[model samples]
Target: MAATVRAAEAGENFPVALRILPARLRSELHATYRYARYVDDLGDELTGDRVAALEAVAAEVRRLYAREPVTDPVVAGMGPLVRRAGVPADCLLRLVEANLRDQDHPRYQSFAELLDYCRLSANPVGEVVLTIFGAATPDRVELSDRICTALQLLEHWQDIGEDYAEGRVYLPKEDLDRFGVTEEDLGAARAGDALRRLVAFETTRAVAWLGAGAPLVSTLHGWARLAVSGYVAGGWAAAGRVRRADHDVLGGQVKPTRSDIAAAWAEGLLRRAG
Candidate 1:
């Protein structure tokens, strides 16, 4: 709980693990936070011993898949949700494997590769949320994939500068080359026209993908729809921010304000009500 609180306070991962959850969900949400934190920590903190840390994460994932109760706080907390939702433990285990994959391979060769990574890194979270809402179905799952993938791409596009600063790149090499961008372009302090165009192109695709999933907001009810709509709206709002910034992602991360989120919330609710 303490670690979860600190992470939220520090504003890592959108304060998602602890803030604004129903009172009934706080405990389990914190547990999920702990699990994600550990996986991330293993990848980032143990960089010097990355291979070993990845092996441990993989082993734990295997154990979880084998139907062993994970004694870790988050894993322990997940047991109830898992049983209640009939969620495949494999999803949780795959999360671990995905984090390890990040340590081994961060750069993507193509848009398809990036989307594949998003499937591993981001899609399962939406699936779990759908299960939590008792709305998991094949159709909703497909919509969830589109929304999650869009969010993942928006995050990547907005963080191009930050990622490059950290000696990593999320921009697909193929797209970068198509836009006449190079590794040297990323090494710049601010984005040049080439990089800007690449971001704009990727942002367009993300917006389109998000739109494809927007109808799911109508397909959901109660707070479940609110949650999904909020996530989808965030992607749209983020894209708007990026566009307003003229795709100057190198300036800094242009995040939507709480007012922006509230507007999205209202828009979603009104649409759902109709």
Candidate 2:
């Protein structure tokens, strides 16, 4: 599991900027990442009874909160940070619940439903990170939700083909129908014109969400500011990649290069500074 987590880190939408962060903060963030990745792997890759596996992780989360011994190494590793940051049990449990939902809910009916799934799968991570930095006010959490949800949408946009192959479709049925994108279109080697149009629409929506959450960067200070800016930068870089591909997501995964991320990072900081 440890090795798998490390390998998966390279492909994350927002790579942990470990070099720029303090040692303790890096460790804390990595612990959180490990826990999340472990749960996701169980839901998406496990060979048998994925729901049961997620339920086990959910039970471990409850144990962590109740001061009982945790059997899962990743959850047990989160003990110190959770206690130190006063991280809410519900935040972590929501992650587990999201995976549980994945087991039963393979397709989303609407964009609102997709956002609700993001509430469970993505927003809680931001909430926990803010709590660790002692910055999770209600207002900040609201902004973080926008940012997290945007990031989740960007990921789904990038992985449309891969997700469809796995018998899961993150694209809402309503949006697909509106754009005349059949499920068969999603599995093709290249996106048809209608699919590209749908992707462009979804990309625009994600970018707007990122813009709505951009204020969260200015509201933070020091490392927190830098970290949040990096996240926003990542979103921008990813959106640019999609646009540069003409929004044809089925051609390949739209991943931003390191240089793209660095350029976006600098631009984000400058914009925030100005």
Candidate 3:
């Protein structure tokens, strides 16, 4: 199956700049997102030594850049985009490194550690988007990093239960200890006071990041502006859902509903217009 079909069938929640971009740009962005999704699935879902599999995937990406034959359909599909749009090879490589880190470290020792992982896992996609859109200045890249990291953190909070089921824990050990939340607390059907407090702390951090990076939206115009604003809005909306749920991530998957995402996008458009 194609990467796009696989991602749709698997129901991955990864977002791209598709909704607001022009048709041509939207196609490029979708192809890029699909490639990333393919790499992530290889690392997370497939059995065996994921480290080796990720390395092989990275090699295919390198081959694509080198104009060599790429066996994987997803990598082959990304070839024209990477070649034409100047998508940085290093940025895509960082994503593979992030997944490799997952194999090496199932739990984070500190918030800083988690942020480092986000730098690898999440920031690259934002950078790739900006690069493809011709808006990747150093300032914009910095802002994009903030938004992407915030989104990654928010996703982590929302999928705490799912991650736990996979034998991975994104909540920093220090925070859990600080809040007196044990691993058992995370596995509970409902979040206890300690887990709630910990989630609240994380939510505050994500909110701060969204606030810090929100300016990126106003820095552009047209489709790029709308796309970035939607990204910022999505982060805000997801974080809002977590807050609205009173940080009870264990009770259910804490994610924004469709209406929440629509509201966020509209609010962002209005803010840009005003």
Q: Model 3, stretches more than 4 Å misplaced?
A: 2-20, 272-274
- Report every candidate's CA lDDT: 0.73, 0.90, 0.83
Identify the runs in model 2 with alpha carbons over 4 angstroms from their true place: none
The TM-score of predicted model 2 comes to 0.98
- What does candidate 3's lDDT look like per residue over 24-53, in tens digits? 787877777787777787888988888888
Model 1 clash pairs are none
- True lDDT of residue 210, candidate 2: 93
Error of 2 at 153 (Å): 0.3
**RMSD after Cα superposition, model 3:** 2.0
Q: After superposing candidate 1 on the true structure, give the runs of residues whose Cα lies further than 4 Å from its correct spot.
A: 1-21, 26-30, 64-69, 270-274
Overlapping backbone residue pairs in candidate 1 total 0
For residues 94-187, what per-residue lDDT tens digits would candidate 2 score against the true structure?
9999999998899999999999999999999999888878899999999999999999999999999999999999999999999999999999
lDDT of 3: 0.83
Clashes of 2: 0
Residue-level lDDT of model 1, residues 1-274, one tens digit each, is 5755574434421334335667545555455556666666667556478767667666665566567856555455566766666766656766677777877686889989888888887787777777777888989999998988898788878777767776678898999889999987877767888888888999999999998988888889876765677677677777878888888888765777666656766776677678
